[model samples]
Target chain A: AQTIHQWPVAEIKAVGSPLSLGCTIKGKSSPNLYWYWQATGGTLQQLFYSITVGQVESVVQLNLSASRPKDDQFILSTEKLLLSHSGFYLCAWSTREVFFGKGTRLTVV
Target chain B: GDKVKQSPSALSLQEGTNSALRCNFSIAATTVQWFLQNPRGSLMNLFYLVPGTKENGRLKSAFDSKESYSTLHIRDAQLEDSGTYFCAAEASSGSWQLIFGSGTQLTVMP
Candidate 1:
């Protein structure tokens, strides 16, 4: 069975600090990967998705970027964190169906 | 303008009862997917619905492209079924950038 993994169940950072979040998929090959953000007590929002290595599409114009450094690895990063970046970040992989990771709760102070 | 909207926003149900959650879309949706977000903050993919109905165990979901809507029916709701349900749609343009509804919070009480 395929499984998705994400790191740092929760995070706290100051504004203007660099940020990085990571995701890895096991038992899947070249599946589409995505990054979704849900604000505190808010709705789910698609942030980015990638179909193949070195390619990603942006859904929302937040100050965030995603990269597919490897086939099974998708990364989300920012040069400097913003207060608005505080939220629940989810990493997912999809072929026929999308499966989400445990997610990382980011609290930017 | 809301491209996708979920109805009721919240619901309460007793165990062994039946209930339905709905999502109405303004965009020309080509595909719909339903998800359940538990209190633990994990989002589980429930169903990836097309323009028809699908059944799995005690749950069923239907998506209507012509009607621009989708419904997830819970049969004999259980206590473990309490959570927020969300519906996301992809336009015929083929962009998998799913636009999600606001979500409906369901509570199944014993």
Candidate 2:
């Protein structure tokens, strides 16, 4: 069985602060990783996706970037956070099916 | 311009009743996935389909690539089933990225 773990279950940050979120997948190797963001009561938006380590594709530009430093590790980061950046962030891995992590709830003050 | 649109933006169902949610895709979707967002904002992947139907317990889903549509049927609705249902489509363009719908909010009443 595969499991995904996301760090800092919840975050509260200032508008100009930098932010970083991390995800790790165990029991699966060389899986496709993706980042998704969803606003309260809004649709889920694909932010970024990586097929392999060292290669990430941007699906939507929201001043956020992602990197798959390792086959099972994905990182989402921002140099400067904006008020609009507050939302629920989810990390997922896909093989034949997609599995999501618990997700991180971010609030920008 | 929503490429993936889910019908009946909101629905209210009584316990033990049945309901079906639908999604229509304007893009050439090669695969479809259904997810449930719980009240706590946790998303659980329910089904992933490749132009076919799948059933799990009281839930059943079907996808038709030719028609560019998908359907999810829930039987014996329970309170725990109250949540937002989302359908995402993967286009045939080889992007392998999911295009999600606005979601259908379902409320099961006791």
Candidate 3:
């Protein structure tokens, strides 16, 4: 069975602080990875997606970037965080079906 | 323009009753997926379809590409079933991006 693990379950940072979130998928190789953001009680927004290592596509520009450094590793990062960047961030992998990770809760102070 | 729209933005159901949620797409979708967001904010995959129907326990879902619509039916609703339901579609344009709906919030009352 495949499993996804996300790091730093929750984080609280200052507006100008830099942020980095990570996700790893085990038991699956060469899967499509995606990053989704959702505000409290808001719709889920697709941020970025990568079909393979070293290639990532931006679905929506939220001032965030993603990289698939490895077949089973995806990273979401930003040079700086904004107040509007506070939300729930989810990492997902897809093959025939999509599987979402537990997600990271970010709060910008 | 709301390419993907879910009807009945919110619903309240009594335990043991049945309810159905629907998603209509304005884009040419080739595949559909259903997910449930629990109260703790965990999203779980319920079904993934390619123009067909699938059933799992008390949940059943159907997708029709021709109609650009999908439906999820829940039987014997339980309190644990209370959560937000979301439907997403992969457009036929060859992009792997899945367009998601606003979601339907379901509250199952005892």
What clash pairs does model 2 have?
Answer: none
Assess chain B of each prediction and give its TM-score. Answer: 0.96, 0.96, 0.96
Residue pairs with colliding backbones in model 1 are: none
Instruction: Give the interface RMSD of each candidate.
Output: 1.0, 1.0, 0.7
Span of 10 residues, lowest total lDDT, candidate 2 chain A: A93-102
* Per-residue lDDT of candidate 3, residues B2-110 (tens digit): 9999987999999999999999999999999999999778998999999999999999999999888999999999999999999999987458788899999999999
Report, for every candidate in turn, its global Cα lDDT versus the true structure.
Answer: 0.91, 0.93, 0.93
DockQ for candidate 3, C-alpha atoms: 0.84
Residue B61, model 2: Cα distance from true site in angstroms: 1.0
For model 3, how does the per-residue alpha-carbon lDDT over A2-99 read when each residue is reduced to its tens digit? 99999889999999889999999999989999999999998888999999999999999988989989999999999999999999999999875778
Clashes of 3: 0
Among all windows of ten consecutive residues in candidate 2 chain B, which has the lowest summed lDDT? Answer: B90-99
* Residue A105 shift from truth in candidate 3, angstroms: 0.3
lDDT of 2 by residue, A77-96 (tens): 99999999999999999975
- Each model's DockQ? 0.82, 0.78, 0.84
The regions of model 3 sitting more than 4 angstroms off are none
Docking class of predicted structure 1: high
Tell me which of candidates 1 and 3 scores higher on lDDT: 3
